[model samples]
Target: MSTTYHAAAVVGCRIPKSKIFLTEKVRECEHNIPESRIKDDEFCAKCGKPLWVTLHKTIPEYNRDMNTLCTFRVFDIEWEDFITVAGPGAVSEVANDCEKPSQLIHLPASDVRKRMERGLEKIGLWDDNEFGIWAILWGS
Candidate 1:
């Protein structure tokens, strides 16, 4: 089976996981900024804290459908280290790094939702929708 690899930078504050707050209602914050304003360097509406933002894009020719098999790994590296290598070329750098592990975690599409729910529950943030769950996970 052919598989695609993907990576995403989860931008958020460096706060404790349990204390992090995420909300999709950006207008509810005191600033009343629209949701579209929630980009890198924007502050959290609920906490009024600054956010770290980075640009990411997928090559149109490499897009994959929801049914595609995929594998990924999350690396918790320093921001300076990440920024130094951040770009389209970074993927090739990672692929060529002999020191890095060759194995990647693979989850079947059928089990994704269930596994995600279990993970969120374990972190006391179950039932959160896409944006909220991702913010909480990355903010912590």
Candidate 2:
């Protein structure tokens, strides 16, 4: 028997996704944000570092789709270019062809965890026990 190998470059994020509902009041600072972009908090999952926030929203697979919330991590790789050798269940690109988020606001793990954890729990993705899980895993 012989072993096969696969290699690729991908940006991974279990990245919290939230929909800004029209019915919800927009923050004064966020009012200028366009519908084509998502303004989110981006922090280092480990070491409590804030990286950035918000990103360009990709062309939606469905037009008029209102709600936008995701529960799992997405591997953003160019699938169209790597599908032949890539493994199954892995992505070639972000869910909606989304781009890198802006790096304006910075927050640490301490500040981001509780908020992300709560949101995940509400969506049934993470359990109460998984709070602060990010602080311990991964390294700089």
Candidate 3:
């Protein structure tokens, strides 16, 4: 019932397929179960895939800090890159604020744009100038 906004980006990177997990479609699965109802050992009755998988890694210490923001990164297998779809304005912002040691990989916007264009082409939407693509990709 509430809406929130944050800055995000799509970073091009290669993630091993072994690390990826699949899940069943929510509410539309054969059992009509939500992701919360699925257990780790359980698989979809229709497709035999997980009901859901946790892809984001959260830092527990940051949870206690009111000033700190948590950024979530989602791996887009089709695009072969990491998409920071929610939370902090930037991943570097979170990394800089971390009390522990951390490293940030900053990719140039031009390079990311190239990959994004390729992803759009893969999906049959080749218009790089399209406002909808930009809005959805950048989470605007």
Candidate 4:
């Protein structure tokens, strides 16, 4: 008996769909910030280096249906400002608490990744590795 060989062609690489969103009108949450509490005794999570009391406010860009969308302010303070730490969940919870009309939208993880990719593309590094992209965002 004779044998026959078959081959399959690859079409595209598999990657998570980018769903990140951007808003140009990001507002800083007016939540009262306590006095400088960060002390030299504090250690960073990754480097374990001493951290100083500091806080900053920024407004990232986003796009949504203006008619159906609502604006909200988020305060992203230094790691020391948080007690339990700030994750996606924590950010959403805080946003909900201080949202307009007491309503806030929680951004999905996939969307977050997409938004990040979009940001990278803006800087001409859309094809970079995940680690590099993340470093850019974290550093910013």
Best by lDDT: 3
Position 66, candidate 3: lDDT: 41
Candidate 3 per-residue lDDT over residues 1-140, each given as its tens digit: 63333322323332232223223334323566555656543668668766555554333312223422122333232453322222212133122222442234355556545654554445343344431111122211
- Give lDDT tens digits, candidate 4, residues 1-140: 64333221111111122222222432233333343533223544445544443433221332223311012122222342211111122132212223333122255545544554554456343442331111001112
Clashes of each: 0, 5, 0, 12
Candidate 1 on 28-122: residue-level lDDT in tens?
A: 23554565776543677567765443444432212134211112112333332221111111122122223453232243333544544454455
Residue clash pairs of candidate 2: 14-73, 40-54, 48-109, 77-92, 79-92
TM-scores across all candidates?
Answer: 0.24, 0.24, 0.25, 0.21
RMSD of each: 17.2, 20.7, 14.3, 20.6
Give the lowest summed-lDDT range of ten residues in model 4.
131-140
Task: List the candidate 1 regions with Cα displacement exceeding 4 Å.
Answer: 1-74, 80-94, 97-105, 131-140
The candidate, 1 or 4, that scores higher on lDDT is: 1
